[model samples]
Target chain A: MEISDTELMLLGLVAEMPRHGYELEQVIVHRAMREWTAIGFSSIYFLLGKLQKRGLIRAYTSRASNRTKAQIPGADSQISDQESEPNTKPRKVFTVSKKGMRILKNQALRSLREISAHYSSLTRGLLQWPFLSREEALAALQDRLEALRSEEDRLSGLQLDQQPLPDYENAMYDFALSQIESEYEWVKRTAEYMETKPWN
Target chain B: MEISDTELMLLGLVAEMPRHGYELEQVIVHRAMREWTAIGFSSIYFLLGKLQKRGLIRAYTSRASNRTKAQIPGADSQISDQESEPNTKPRKVFTVSKKGMRILKNQALRSLREISAHYSSLTRGLLQWPFLSREEALAALQDRLEALRSEEDRLSGLQLDQQPLPDYENAMYDFALSQIESEYEWVKRTAEYMETKPWN
Candidate 1:
């Protein structure tokens, strides 16, 4: 089964430990996973429900009225599922099944091995160079250079704020920063080259 | 006005010169534009019609029966309308309007100036490294290395096939190839680092 990036992250988190929807949101925020994946706070429950429907995960809630709620030893006490109001919904804790774990492993490996193309809009703009005058083109590239610098600063700030990261997380941050820096250098060089070349 | 990458490309192409749907498809294929922008051949007419409706472009057909058909002097002879059958539809030749030209210029500049985030799924996989075993991780990276090499070969081959390109097109191609090469180097270094370090 092809899982989305958000699904993979959520499934991996659950595989790490049984977690409720709120707990998953905390882990995502704590790790700044939003920088890499699109996981809206509102969509967490929706995604969990989808995963449960797929049999990749099983949910256990501490409500006797809910038919799908599975009974676990001391589950009601552990979760502190206080149904203070009649309208209060049952909070379910999700755990990955064996099938989910197998799929996660396979998908992770497939993701690593694949070389998906990253298309940039700038390439399209460059292809349509005739649309913009030479002055406009140079100014746009200059503006891009400034934006790249600000982006570098912003990313660095984010990394600093999320300090004492795991070795793997640190490596990911480094890779991202390296990519932006590389692009910055490319734009600078391209701008200089464009300045010297005659407009076609 | 927000325009998609494909729309921008198509609009810019029209601004360069009035072209029929079939001609636009040919230009896209001959230039290998599908690698950068998602412009399917079937969507050309749909998008053109949308642009016309939005008043960013106007279409001229050489049919007298068609009310929307415009009369460009000698357009029938120029386009060879050839409406022998009662069911035959007149081929539309789309041209960018003055307003279209202004918007296209602004959009092209904005596209150049903006630095949109390019999220990679590999980053997500790397973040969830805890799910994969050490051997599995190394093997995946190795497979990725091989894939990157093949990708490099393929991109190089494509560039070679489209020889004697314009300077701007050459620059765009170089930027793309450079990005892949940089990623390959990063992956190689990362794999080596992972080899020596203890897996978490």
Candidate 2:
């Protein structure tokens, strides 16, 4: 039940106040500094759907704008009619549940811990690189690869049974998997190359 | 002119021996550990196209097995099969051009520098966080936000006019942008919250 960055943002928004999908989209664009932030319109809906499915958010139907179409003579009917009419679909309002609040707190704490761990691990790895032999480097890479592969397997298994995620969430997961796989491959190739060549 | 990680690998493979698209793909998969490396099929073609366009790679019709049709059943079945399927769609045979090789060397150096810079920057940012007063933190966050926005503008402008990029290269650019934007938004919100809270 690990929340992604998108989920974290969605929850944080809801925690501030109850909001529907469009409103949430507007808030994210206006308040989140759109010059830097680039959440697409579809991504907002995707995140809102995920939050609701996870039971972190509750959605309720709200009255939305409805405009009647009027027939106009000598006009491109299809284009003009569609433009004049307003969307009539019921808007879904979302509020953060108690479970959502707990998840947010847990995620924040986890992020702080991860940031510290990443910093220390990166520092140690850099410092040790010059002193280590090729074999040691290979071994270190293998250990990291194994851990990443395990995480990939875990996420893959989830994909098989879990409901299809929204495009953005799926994209995020794919990106993470690709990054881990890329690193693992690079390490393996370097190791093989090093083994064959005369060690400098 | 810029070589991404996947492009670099492709260049390395070509440096070893001249290869066509299918052969290069296989080499990437088997010899280079591409599955672990996270290089996708689309990325191979994309890089090949770019390299050829840049005159860094050459194409030749080889008597290679074109299994593409066999892989896809009868989408265009009217045409009779021939005994020798000359890879007429220009099976790209890549060789490391002098310019390409020079670029690759520079890229390796740049990558190493970037890794060190990233580690130092992350460390500096995190350490500085604990030392800053509320006002200072808010100012710092604003500066970062502005910088990120400028970066996003550059990326978007680059994307709009440039030729299509390989999947891995595109992914790297996108992932970097997303990471910075998320952090920028988070810092801005956190700064606002801190401004309201009473410091003990």
Highest TM-score: give the candidate number.
1
Residue pairs with colliding backbones in model 1 are: none
Tell me model 2's lDDT, rounded to 2 decimals. Answer: 0.54
Could you tell me the TM-score of candidate 1?
0.86
- In candidate 1, position A56 carries an lDDT of 90
lDDT of 2 by residue, A1-200 (tens): 88765567667778778888777778765542222223568888888888889999898875544323333456776776577554546667789898987776555444332321111122223222333456655555566556657857865665444446533234334434554455446545545654676644
TM-score of chain A of each: 0.83, 0.45
Q: What is the Cα-based lDDT of residue B41 in candidate 2?
A: 84
Q: State the lDDT at B103 in candidate 2.
A: 61
* Candidate 2 backbone collisions, by pair: A182-B37
List the candidate 2 regions with Cα displacement exceeding 4 Å. A33-38, A64-89, A116-200, B1-5, B12-94, B97-200
User: Which one is best on lDDT?
Assistant: 1
Error of 2 at B142 (Å): 24
Per-prediction interface RMSD in Å = 1.1, 14.4
Question: What C-alpha lDDT values do all the predictions have?
Answer: 0.83, 0.54
